[model samples]
Each structure stands twice: as structure tokens, then as C-alpha cells.
Target chain A: AQSVAQPEDQVNVAEGNPLTVKCTYSVSGNPYLFWYVQYPNRGLQFLLKYITGDNLVKGSYGFEAEFNKSQTSFHLKKPSALVSDSALYFCAVRAQPYTGGFKTIFGAGTRLFVKA
Target chain B: DVKVTQSSRYLVKRTGEKVFLECVQDMDHENMFWYRQDPGLGLRLIYFSYDVKMKEKGDIPEGYSVSREKKERFSLILESASTNQTSMYLCASSLRLALLSYNEQFFGPGTRLTVL
Candidate 1:
């Protein structure tokens, strides 16, 4: 079984300031991590994914996440925050099973509040 | 651009009433999924279909059923809607079965259902 943990329930940041949302995971095999954002009453939008690549992975809306193997963490970061960035973010992980398809597990979600 | 569309944006139902939430994807993707999103629970998979008429149970399948009569459409059915079942439902589609190359899912705008 695979699980993802997002420690922060809410993160506040000022405009133009950098922001980080922490995430960690527990899985049996290679990890396929993902980040998604959801606005009020909207569905989740895929921001990025880390399948197998360099540790630092860049995503949409000027967002990026770092995959730390030893730390078992994948933290989402943005150099500058925008008021439009205020939303709910979720971290997810799926193990690459030998049985053909993968089942993704999602975290509890982190609410980001970016103030201008 | 690929788009996933849900039939309803907002739904109001009562307990013991049967509910149907429909989703369609225009990309002709091989995999389709249904998930329920809560305030803090993030996204929990209810069911997924890899192909037409083939469904698999996801994390939370109890009290919920799904149908995929066509490859482009997936339907989620709640035999008895409860207060606990009131949440935002999301639909997503992804391409798979191609040997695990990097594949991302496209999501719909979501359907907000309320069971009283």
C-alpha cells in the first residue's frame, strides 16, 4: 500500500514571496508523485508529476517540486506567490505495480492563501 | 486541448435517493476515473474503468457503483445518497497501457453534490 502525507493544513504567503508546501510519502516500490490544485468548487488540476527524472521538477503556474529520495519528500515550491494562487493543493503518489495499471493515493490537501 | 466534462455542476439530493453523476472525456483515453473530493480528505477514488464495460473498485467503493457503457463516458451511481456522501465529485481521464511512459490525467470541472 502507498500513502501520501501533507503536513500543512494552511500556508499563508505574501505576494512576490516564495512559498513551499511540504509533502511526504510511503510506498513499496518506485514512486510516481504528483501535485494538483483546486479552486473553489472546482475539480483538481494537474500541476506536475515526478516519474523518473532529475530531483528538481518544474510544473505549471511557475510551480516546482523536489523529489528527495532519502527524505521521502516531495515539496512544492514557487518563487513568487500570486493572489490567484490561493487554492487547495494536494500531493499524491502511486506505486508502479507489476500488474499493468497503477492506483494513485492522495494526501489530505494543503490550503494555500496568497495575499497581495 | 483535451477536455473532461461532467454532466452536473451542482446537485441536491435527499437520503435514500439514487444519484447518477456522468462524466465524459473527449480525448479517447483508455483509462477513466471517478473521485470524490472533500474539504480536507483531498480526492478519494470511487471507481475506475480501464476500458468499456470494465470497472474496478477504488479506495471507497461502498455504497457507490459505476458504469462505463462507452469508452468516452463513465457514470457513477450512488444507491443511497447519505449526508456523508455529500461532496464534490471529480472525473478524470488518462492514457495508459503503453508500457508506463509518462502519462498525466486531465480532469473535469467537477460536480458538487449535496445530500440532505
Candidate 2:
């Protein structure tokens, strides 16, 4: 089974400071990881993904994530936090099993509060 | 640009009432998915369809069903709305590309359902 875990329930950061949201995953096969953000009353917006490329993957809104194989983690990061960036962050992992059917498993989201 | 739209922004229903949540995607994608988002649960897949008229149960499909009679439209059905089922429903569509590059899943704005 493929599953993800977000250790933090919430994270607080000052505007202009760097931000990080942690996530770890367990999958049977190769990992296809993703990061998404959600605002209040809205759905998720794709942030970035890691398939087989560079460790650091850049995504929308100046967000990025690093995939660490040894640690089994894919943590979302931003160089400088913005107050508007306060929202919920989700980390998802796809189990690339040889089986034809597969689904993405998401972590219990982490709420981010960026203070102005 | 790929866009996904949900039929309603908010809905209120009583117990034992039948509820329908519709989703449409502008992109001609082959895969459509329905997920429920809770505060700490992040997102749990309720159902998914790989093609027209083909649906598959997801992680949490116990109280819900899905319809995908057409390529662009997917509808989630709740036979009896329950208070525990009150949550934000999100729809997503994505092309079934190679496993290495299929992490991009476009999502709708989501519908908030409250069951009394």
C-alpha cells in the first residue's frame, strides 16, 4: 500500500522568511510524488512533482520540493514566505506498481500560517 | 489551459437525502477522480474513472458512488447524506500519460457539502 505522512499539524513562519513543510511516504514501487496547496473554500492547486528528475523540483508560486530517497521524504519549501501563502499543504505519493490500476495517496495536510 | 469546474460551491442536505455533485473538465482527459477533503485527513479518493462508463472504487468509496457516462463529465452520488460525510469534495482530471510524468492532476474549485 502507498501512504504518506505529514508530521506537522501546523507551521508558522514570518513573511520573507524561508518555509518548509515536511512529508514522508511509503510505497511498494517507484514513487511519483506531488505537492498541492489549498486555500479556504477552494480546491487544491498543484505545486510541484518529482518523478525521476533533479532532487529539487521548482513549481508554481515560487515553491519547490526536494525528493530524498534515503529519507523517504518529499518536503515542500519556499525561499521566502508570503502572507498570502498561508493555507493548507498536502503531499501525495503514487505507487508505481506494475499493476494497471493505481491511485495517489495524500498525507494528512499541514496548515501553514505566514504572518505579515 | 486545462480547467475543471464543479457544479455547486456549497450544498446543504438533510439525513437520508440523496445528493449529487457534478464535475466537468474542459480538457479531454481520460482519467477523472473524486476526492473528499477533511481538515486533517487531507484528501481521500472516493472514486475514479479511467474512461467513459468505467468507474473504479477508491480508498473511501463506502457511502458514495460515481457516474461517468461521458468523457467530460463525472458525477458523485451519495445515497444517503450523513453528518460524517459533510466535507469538501474535489474533482480532478488528468491525462493517463506514462507513469514517470503523470503527476499533473488539475482540480476543480471544490464543493462544500454540509449534511444535517
Candidate 3:
């Protein structure tokens, strides 16, 4: 079974400070990981994905994630946090389909609170 | 740009009522998925359709059914809406031919259902 774990229920950071939202995964073969962000009353927006190649993948809104093969982790990072950046973050891993296509398993989510 | 749209942003229903949540994607995606989001629980897949008339149970398919009569639309059915089933429902679609590594899902704005 492919699964993702987000250890933090909530993370607090100050504006302009670096922020990290941790994520780890367990999968059968190589993992395909993704990061999504959800704002108040809005649907989730794709942040970035780690499929192949570059360990460091840049994504939208000045966000980036580093894929650590040995650690089985893909942590979302930002060099400088903004109050607007505070939102619910989700980590997901794609699972191979049994009979048809692919399925994605998502983590419980991490709520980020950036203080101004 | 890919656009996924849900039929409603908010809905209220009584217990035991039959409820339908509809999703449509403008992109010609071969795979469509339905997931429920709860606070702290993130997103749990309820059902997925790989092609028209083809549907598969996801992680939490109990108490719910789905329909995919056309390639562009997928509908989730709740036979008897229960309080426990009250949550945000999200619909997503992805290209089937894309490699597993690059099969990124585009999500709808989501429907928040309240069963009282």
C-alpha cells in the first residue's frame, strides 16, 4: 500500500522566516509525490510534484520541495513566509491501480499559520 | 488550462435523503476521482472512474455510489445521507496516458455538504 504521513498537525512561523511542512511516504516502487494547498473556503491548489529527476523541484508561489530518496521524504519549503501563505497543506502519493488506473493516497494534512 | 467544476459550493440535506454531487472537467481526461475532505483527516478517496461506464471503489466507498455515464462528467451518489458523511467533497481528473510519474490530477473547487 502506498501512503503518506504528515507528522505536524499545525506549524507556526513568522513572516519572512523560512518555513517547512514535513512529509514522508511509503510505497511499493519509486514514489510519485505531490503537494497541495487549500485556503479558507477554497479548493486545493497544486503546489508542486516530485516525479523524476531533480531532487529539488520548484513550484508555484515561491514554493519548493526536496525529494529525499533515503529519507523517503518530500518536504515543502519556502525561503520567506508570508501571512497569505498560511493554509492547509497536503501530501499525497500515487498508488498503482489494481484493475484500471492509478489512485492517490493523501496524508492527514498540516495547517500552516504564518504570523505577521 | 484545465478546469474542473463541481455542481455546488454548499449543500444542506436531511438524514436519509438521497444526494447527488456532480463534477465536470473541461479537459479530456480519462481518469476521474471523488474524494471527501474532513478536518484533520485530509482527503479520502470515495470512488474513481477510469473511463465512461467504468467505476472502482476507493478507500472509503461505503454509503456512497458513483456514476460516469459520460467522459467529461462524474457524479457521486449518497444513498442515504448521514451526519458522518457531511464533509467537503472534491472531484479531480487526470490524463490516463501520462506516465505514472507525471499523472498530475486537477481538482475542482469542491462542494461542502451538510447532512443534518
Quick one: best TM-score, which candidate? 3
Candidate 3 error regions (>4 Å): B98-101
Best by lDDT: 3
Candidate 1 collision pairs = none
lDDT of 2 at B1: 83
* Docking level of model 1: medium
**True contacts recovered per prediction:** 0.62, 0.63, 0.62
TM-scores, all models, native as reference = 0.95, 0.95, 0.97
- Give the per-residue lDDT digits (tens) of candidate 3, residues B16-94: 9999999999989999999999988889999999899999998899999999999999999999999999899999998
Measured against the true two-chain complex, the DockQ scores of the candidates, in the order shown, are 0.65, 0.65, 0.67
* Candidate 1 true-interface contact recovery: 0.62
RMSD of each: 1.5, 1.5, 1.2
For model 1, residues A14-111, the per-residue Cα lDDT tens digits are 99999999999999978889999988877788999998869999999999999999999999999999999999999988766433556788999999
Given candidate 2, what's the lDDT at residue A3?
Answer: 80
Docking class of 2: medium
Candidate 2 interface RMSD value: 2.0
lDDT (C-alpha) at residue B95 in model 2: 88
After superposition, which runs of candidate 1 have C-alpha atoms over 4 Å from their true positions? A98-100, B99-102
Estimate candidate 3's alpha-carbon lDDT, on a 0 to 1 scale. 0.92
What TM-score does structure 2 among the candidates reach?
A: 0.95
